[model samples]
Target: MNKKLSYNVAIVGATGAVGKQIIRLLEERDFPIQQLKLLASKRSKGTIVEFKGKDLVVEEATPESFEGVDIALFSAGGKTSRSLAKIAVAKGAIVIDNTNAFRMDEDVPLIVPEVNMEEAKNHKGVISNPNCSTIQMVTALKPLYDRYGIERIIVSTYQAVSGAGNQAINELIVQTKQILDGKEVTKEILPVSSLPKKHQIAFNAIPQIDVFEDNGFTLEEMKMVRETKKIFGDPSIQVTATCVRLPIIYGHSESVYVELKEEYDLKEVRELLMNAPGVVVIDDPANQEYPLATDSAGKLDVFVGRLRRDLDHPRALNMWIVSDNLLKGAAWNAVQIAEHLIRNDYNESK
Candidate 1:
C-alpha cells in the first residue's frame, strides 16, 4: 500500500506485443522509474521477460495488482482494460489505456501528445490512446487544422496484420509460405476471431476490421471517424473511413483527403507540415520517393507524402500518411502520456 512513488509503473498485458514494446520504449527512453512491474493474464503469470538488463516475472493482473503503482499502462484488450482500469485508477494510479476502453468516455481525454499535450493534464485518472490510424491522421492534420482550419477528412487505411495480434502476424507468415509453395492458404483469423466468417489475409485484403454496428460502419472505421473528432476536439470536422487489413506488418498507412475551411496554397501546406513536430514530409514524386510501410517500420515519426491539391476543389487536398502501428500508434503514444505527466509535474492524484 506504500505507493509513495518514485515512479512505480505497472504494465498490464505485459506479455502482449504492444506491452513488450512499451517496456522497451520506457527502458530505451530511460524513463524515470524506481520500480517496474509486469502484469499479464493468469495464463501468462510465470513468464519471464527482459527489461533494461533485468529479468522481471510477469504477474497475473487483478484489481489488487495496481495497489502500489503510480502509473498503469493497459493494452490487454478492451474487456480486460474495462474491468481493471477503474480499479487501477481507484488505487491512486493514473492509467494510460491503449485499448478502446475509455476512448469515447466524456471524462477521459483521448490524446495524441504532439497534437494536444495540454489535454494530458486534465486526466480523470484515465487517458485513452487514440486509434492507430487516427493517431497518424491527426498528427498529419494538426498543422493544417491549426493553421488553415480543417473542415472534413476522408481516410482509407491499409493496416498491417500485426495490429490484430502476434498470432495474426504468425498467421500471415504461415499463409504466405503456403502460397509461395503452391499450397492452399488457411483462413481462421483475419477480421475478428470471434466473428463467424474469417477472411484469407495471405495475399488478399479485408475491408473490414471490427464487427459492424447498426449504422453499417465497422468498429475500426468508426473508431477512425469518431476518434479523429475527439482528438482534434472539433466535432464539425467530418470524417469517414474504410479500414482494411493488408498483407503488411508493422506500419499503418492511410490515404487521407481533406478540405480546409480556409483555402491555402500547396507550398504553404508543405511548409506547415515540414515545420510541425513529430511529422516528416516525403513528398517528391519525381524522385520516386514517398511514405511506404517497409520504410516506416521500426520508426517513431509519422511520415506524410503524395501531397497535392484537388484540381476541382481548391480547398481540398490529398496525402499519404504512415507510422509504425506498434510504436507511435500504440506503445510510443502511451509512453508519451506518461512523459507528459512527468514533465508537467502531475502527481498521482491527477
Candidate 2:
C-alpha cells in the first residue's frame, strides 16, 4: 500500500470481523495513515486483507509490531488485549481496545467519546470502548441526562448473535435453515460458550448473556451497570439491567426505562434526542415510526424512539434504542476514540 501520512497505524486482530471493520472505516473516513500494519494471530498470519484497493498481508502480532506505531486498534478479544495492550502502550502506541479485559480497570477509561471524551484524554496507555449496548444507550441518554437530570435506568436488551462474534451469528442462521427443513438445530454458543448449557438462539430470546455473577446478574448486565456509572460519571445514578441475546445478526436493540430527577415533558425529550450527537430520535407512534434493529443495521447513529412516560412510574420514560452491534458498538466506537485522540492530541486535563 502507498504511504499517506506520518502516523503509523496498527490494527491488532486485523483478520477478525471488527478488526476488518476498523480498517474499512479508516479508509472510508480517509484517516491519514502513513503505515498500515495488519496484525493477527499466528494462525492468521499471511492472510491477505484488502485496504484502499490494495491487498495487504496480515502479520503475527507481537510487542514488536507496535514499535513506532502511533495508534493501535485492538479487537482480538479480552485475552489478546490483556496480553498485548500493555505492550503496545509500553511502545508508545495508543491502544484503543475493543474488549472487556480492561474495561473495569480503574486506570483504564471506559469511553463513549460523544458522551465523555474527557476520559479519553487521561489514558493510561489503554482506552476502553464501552459495551455496544451501553454505547447506544448512553449516547441517547446524555442530552436528557444533562437537561432533565436522570435518576435511574432500567434496560432490557434485544441484542444480536453477532455481538457474541461471527460464529454465533453463523450458528443462528444455520440452525434456522435446518429447523425450517425439519432438521435438528444444535446449541453450543449462546448465553455463554464456556457454560455447561447452551440454548437455541434462532427465533428465541435467551435471557442470559455472559456468565452470571454472585448477584445473579450476567457479566453483560454488570457491564451495563458499571459502565453506565463510569460513562455518566454519576455512580449515584441507579442502573438495573437484563441483557438478552436474540437471533438478529447485525444490530442490537434496547428497551430502556429511565426516571428523570425532574419531571420531563415527553416532547422536550424527543427534541433533545433529535439534536443529540450520534443519535436519531423517531417518535411518531401514529404512523408507527420507531427504532428497529433491521432499520438500524449498518447505520452509525443510535436510533431512539417509542418515547412516552412510564404508565406506573410517573417520573420515568420508556423508549427503544438500536444500532449496528459491530459498527457503533465495537469497531466504530474504537475508531471514534482514535479520531478523538488525533483531534485532541490526547490531552484531557487541559
Candidate 3:
C-alpha cells in the first residue's frame, strides 16, 4: 500500500456523454492507469475513442470484459449497471456505479466524496454516485448540516437538458433552429422520450424528470429525497423535491430551503460555507454577484449563493446551488471515489 501503484481500469458505456467526460477527467487528472479498457453496447463495438493521443477501440461489454480490471466505472444506465456491476465485482474490480441501480441498496454506499467519504470504506463490492442534483445539493448542505442539525428540506431544481444524455442536447438545438426558421419543430425527446407525450425543450421548462410515480413524484425527485437520507445516514431528515428540466445545456441549479433544528445567524452560515471544502460562495447580491449555471459549467466545485433567512420561518434559510451536471454530478464524482479508494487501499470485500 505504501508504493505507488497503477490500476487496470475499465469504463462501461465509454461512448456516452458522461462516459466521455469520465475518460477526459481520468486523463486530465492523471489517474494511475496501467491499462485502460473502453466498453459499450454491441452496437458501439469497433468504435474508436482517443485517449492520451492514442485511438482505443471500444468493445462490447460482457462479464469477461472485467477479468483484470482493478476499477470499473459504470455510467451507461441503470439497466446496464444492474446486470454488469455484480460481474465486475466478482472479477475483483471495485465498481463505482453512476447509475441508480444500487443507490438505494442497503449494502451499497451512496457517496459524495466531500459529504460522506467514510461511508465508502464499508462498501461490500459496490459503491454508488448520487444523482446529479442530489450530489450538488448535498455537497453544499453538508457543512450546514454538521454545524446546525437539519430538520427538513424543500428543493426545486432547474436542471439542464444534458442530464437526459446526448440525444436531448441535440433535440434542443434542432428544435431551436426549426423555430427560428419558421419550420415545424420535430419532437422525439424531452420530459420523457419513451412516453407517448413529448414536450418542446427549446425555450421551455418541463416540470417533470423521469416518469411519475403513484405518489405524484417523478423518479428523479424521489431519488433526491431517498438518496439524501442515505448519504447523510439520517433517515429522520424530511426531504422533498420538485425536479424540472430547463433549456440550458451544462449545469443543474437548485433553490434549496432548509429548516435547521437550531437557530443560526446569517453571517455565520455564510462564513461556514465559505470555509467548506468543494464549495464556493458568491453571495454579494448588491454587486449582482451570484452563482449562475453558465459560470459553473465545466467547473468541479459546487457554487452556492443568494444566502438568506426565510422571512416567514424563524429557523429556515434559503440558498441557490449550481454545478456541472456532467462533471461533479456524474463523472467527476465517480472519479473522486476511485481516487479515494486507491489512496486508502480500500478493500472491496469489506
Candidate 4:
C-alpha cells in the first residue's frame, strides 16, 4: 500500500506462545516482509528466535522500537498493549493488536476477517482481534447469520490450556504426572493466575475462564457477548456464554445454540457453512465424523459439526465448533487482517 515491495514488520511479545505462532505463520504464509523485528519483555531479551532460517534476537520493547516499523502485530498482554500500541501507531505503523485492551474502544475496529473486515477499514491506526473463543464461533456463524438471521446465541466452550500461555501448559503436564505418581498435584495457574486460588486443570473442567464480573459472567464469556454484537453490527441479537477451561493442550471447542428469526432448512444450513470461507464442515454422523480438538489442533480452519435443529424451538439450531486457540483464534486472525490491509490497499491515500 505504501508503494514498497514489502513492509517492515515487528512482532511484540515475540517470545510467548501466541507470538511464536505469529512468527511461524508469517513465514509459512510467505507474507511479504522487508524486515522482521522481534520484541519482548526485559526478561525475554537476548532470546534467540528463528525466522526464515535466520536467527533473530528478541529485544526489550521500548518506545523507540517502532521507529521504522510498518506493521506491528501485538500479542503481548493487554497491559503492554495499552502502554505501547498507540506509540507504535503514532510512529506510522498499523497495529493489529491481539489483546482485549482496545477491542471495545469506539475508535478501534474489532475484526475477525471472515466476519467483519469492513469495520477494519475505519481503523484509526489500530485494529483489535477478538477473544480466542469468539473468533471461531463468529466465523462459523457468519454464514448462517446472513442467511437465517440469528436472534439469540447461547454458547458453552471447552477451551484449551495453551490459551493461558506456556506456563499453564507446563502446569497441566506437571499436575498430570504428579497425580499419576501419587504425589500431591500442584495447583497454580488455572482459572486465573493472579487470584489467591488456583485449580488443577488435568482430568478436570474448570467452569471459569478469566475473572467473573458482578453479573456472574466471566470476562471470557462477556467478551463473546460484546464482541459478537460488534462484529455482526447487530445489538438486538441476544448472546450469552459459559466458558470452561479443559485439560486439552491446543484447540478450543464450543457447543453453540442459536435461535434464528426465520425458519431454516437443515440441508441448506449445512450447504451454507460448507460454502463459507475459513470454515470446514465435518457433520457426517453416520461414520462418526465430527470436529474434535485433537483433529483440529495445528489447523487454521474452524471445524464445525453436530449440526441439528432444536426440538422445542422450531427456528432454533445447535452445533459444535472447533479451532486451534492460538492459530485461527489469535495469531492467524491477526495476520489475516494485515494481509487484508495489503490486498485492499488500505490507507494508501495517506
Candidate 5:
C-alpha cells in the first residue's frame, strides 16, 4: 500500500475504558486521519462518542465494517476480535488488537512498541498488544535485557480494578461507599465475571485475575509468562507471575525480581533506566521518592523505582513497575503500534 496524505481509522469497542483513551490519545497526538469510525457491540450502537470536539456515533461492528478502513484498533473482548479481526484484515486494514485473541498466534505479532516495534513490520495483518500487566513489566525490563541478558524473572502484580472492565470499577466504588455507610456490600463482577463465584474488590486483594489453569497458574499469570518470552523473542528466559486484583482504580503495579546473566553496578543500572525511552525512573528512596499508583494514573510512560541489588544473588535486582492499566498498558500502546504502522507504511506485502 502506498502512503496516503491521511488514512481512515476505525476503533472497535469504542465505548470501552481503553477504547476511550485511544480516541483521546489519537486526537492529542494529532494523528493524521482523513476519517474516523467508531465500532462497538450492537447494544452500544447509536451511542455518541466525542472525538476531537466532534460527536461520532458508535456503529455495530460487522465483517463489512472494515470496508474502506486503513487501520483498525480493537479493544473489544477476545471473542469479538476473533470473529472480526480477520475480516478487517481481509478488507485491507491493519488490525492492532488489544486482546488475547491473537497474542499467542504464531501468525500474529505480539507488540510492545518500546520493546518490539520491529516485529510490526512482519505482521500478517494483525498485531496484538500485550496484557496490561505484561506491557509495563516488559517495557521496564527491555533496557536491562539488552545490556545484561535476563536469566529469570519473578513478578507479582497488583493490578487495578479497571483491568476487569467498567463494571468492576463500579463495584469497587459502590462497595467502598456501602462499607462506609455500614450497608451490605454487593458481591459481583470480580475475580472472574463469568464464573459463579464473585469477590468484593473494594479494600481487598484477590490472588487470581483470570481463571486458573491446570498447572495452578491463572490465565493472567500465564499470559505474562508466555508473552514476555514472545515479546523478547527469547523462550529460554524463565518467567513466573502471580497476578492479583487490587482496589486501585487505574494503575497496575508490579514487584519484579529479575536475575541477569551479568553482574552490574547499581548506579549504571539506574542510568540505563533513566535514559530508556518510554520509561521514567524515580528511585530516590532517601527523599521518599518512588513510583506510586496514584502518581502513575493517566500517565503513558511506565514508571520504575525501588531499584536495588537482590540480597541472595549478585546479578539479580528488584524493582517496582507502575503504569496506567488503561493507557500505556492498553490504549497508549495500541496507538503507538498504529503510529508505527503509519510511519513505516506497513503492509503484509512489506
Candidate 6:
C-alpha cells in the first residue's frame, strides 16, 4: 500500500452525532478518500447525508460493507461494534472503534494520539478510542506526566447530555422549556437510558453517567480510571473519577487533581502544557480567563486552565480541562489515528 494513495473509508453509525462530526472533519482535514461509505442501522439506512457538497445515501451496515474498505470507523454502540468490528477486521480493514467493546482487550490498542500514538502501529487489526472524558484528560495530563511522574489522578467530570446521544440532548432542551413554562416535565432518557429510573437534567445534575459497576463506580467513571492506565502504559498510576451529567449541550468539563512524584514549579508546569501538542492553555486568573464548556464546543483542541498548586499537597496540582466531547474526544481522535496510520504507512509490510 502506498502512503500517498487515497483509500476507501467506511463510517459506521453515519447518521449519529459523532458520526456526523467525523464526516465533517474528514472533509475539513482533507483526508485522502478514494471512496466514502456511509453506514447505519436498517432504520437509518435510506437517510441521506451531505458530504463535500454531495448527498450520500447511507446503507445498512453488514459484513460485506468492509469488503474494499481500507479503514472503518465504528461509533454505533458496543453491541454493534462487538458484532461487526471483528468482521471488518477479517475483511482486511483496520477498525477504529469508539465504543467500550474492545477498549480493555489486551490485544487491542487503546489510543489517545497525543499520549501514545506509537501503540497504533502494534494494532492487531482493531484500535479502540478512549472514552470522551478520558481523551481530554489524558491529552492535558500527558505533558505533565512526561515532565513530572504522576502518582495519582482524581477527576470529577461535568459531562454534557450530548455524550448520551442526540436523544438526550433533545430531552434536555424539552425539559428545560417545560420547566421554564411551568409545564409538566417528562423524562425518559438520562443517567442510564437502560435503567428503569430517570432524572431531570435541565435544571439539575445527575450524579451518574453510565450504569453502576460492582465497585460502586459508574461505567463512565471506570472507563477514565482503566483507560488512563492503558493509554499511558503504566498500571502503577492510580486514578479515580466521579462522572456527572450536566445540562450542557456540547462540551465536557473536568476538574482534575494530579499528584506528581516530584515537586513542580507552577510557571514551568504551565509552560509545559502550553507547549504540548493538541493542548491549549487558557489560564489567566487576573483576567478571569479559563477554559469554558461553551468556548470549547466544536473545537478540536483540549483546553486546560486554572492551573494552581494544591494547598495541602506539595506535589499536587489542580486544573480544569474542557473539550468538545463529540470532536477531539471522539471523532477527531479517531481521525487522528487514521491520519497517523496513513502517514506511517500502516498497511505496508505490516
**RMSD vs true structure, all candidates:** 1.8, 2.4, 1.4, 1.0, 0.9, 1.1
In model 5, the Cα lDDT at residue 32 comes to 93
Model 6 misplaced regions, further than 4 Å? 1-4, 347-350
Q: Count the backbone clashes (under 3 Å) in each candidate.
A: 0, 0, 0, 0, 0, 0
Which stretches of candidate 2 lie above 4 Å from their native place?
Answer: 1-5, 347-350
Better of 2 and 3 by lDDT: 3
> What is the lDDT of every predicted structure here?
0.90, 0.87, 0.93, 0.93, 0.93, 0.94
lDDT of 1 by residue, 1-350 (tens): 23333689999989887998999999999998888999999999999999888899999998889877888999999999999999998998889999998999998989999998787767888999988889989998999999989898888899999898888898899999999999988878877988989888988989989889899899999998899888888899899898999999789999999999998999999999999999999989999889999999889999999999898988999999999999999999999888878777555336
lDDT of 5 by residue, 1-350 (tens): 44888889999999988888999999999999999999999999999988889999999999989999998999989999999999998888889999999999998899998899988878888999999999999999999999999999999999999998888889999999999999999998998998999988888889999899999999999999999999999999999999999999989999999999999999999999999999999988899999999999989999999999999999999999999999999999999998888888767554
Error of 5 at 292 (Å): 0.5
List ranges where model 1 is wrong by over 4 Å: 1-5, 347-349
Candidate 5 clash pair list = none
Candidate 2 residue lDDT tens string, 1-350: 11224578999989776887889899999987888999999999999988989999999998789888888899888989999999988887788899899998998889998889887777778889998889989999999989988899999999998888767978899889989999888877777887999899998999999888999999999999999999988999999999999888888999999999998888888889888899998778899899889998778889998998888877899999999988999889998888877876874432
Positional deviation of 86 in candidate 2, in angstroms?
0.5
Task: Give per-residue CA lDDT, model 3, range 1-350, as digits (tens).
Answer: 22248999999999998999999999999999999999999999999999999999999999999998889999999999999999998887889999989999999999999999988878888999999999999999999999999999999999999899999999999999999999998999898887999999998989999999999999999999999999999999999999999899999999999999999999999999999999999999999999999999888999999999999999999999999999999999999999999998767345
Residue 314 Cα positional deviation in candidate 6, in Å, after optimal superposition: 0.7
Q: Which regions of candidate 3 fall more than 4 Å away from where they truly are? A: 1-4
Superior by TM-score: candidate 3 or candidate 4: 4
- Candidate 6, residues 1-350, lDDT tens digits: the string is 34658989999999898999999999999999999999999999999899899999999999989898889999999999999999998888889999999999998999998999987877889999999999999999998899998999999999999899989999999999999999999999997889999999998989999899998998999999999999999999999999999999999999999999999999999999999999999999999999999999989999999999999999999999999999998999999999999988665334
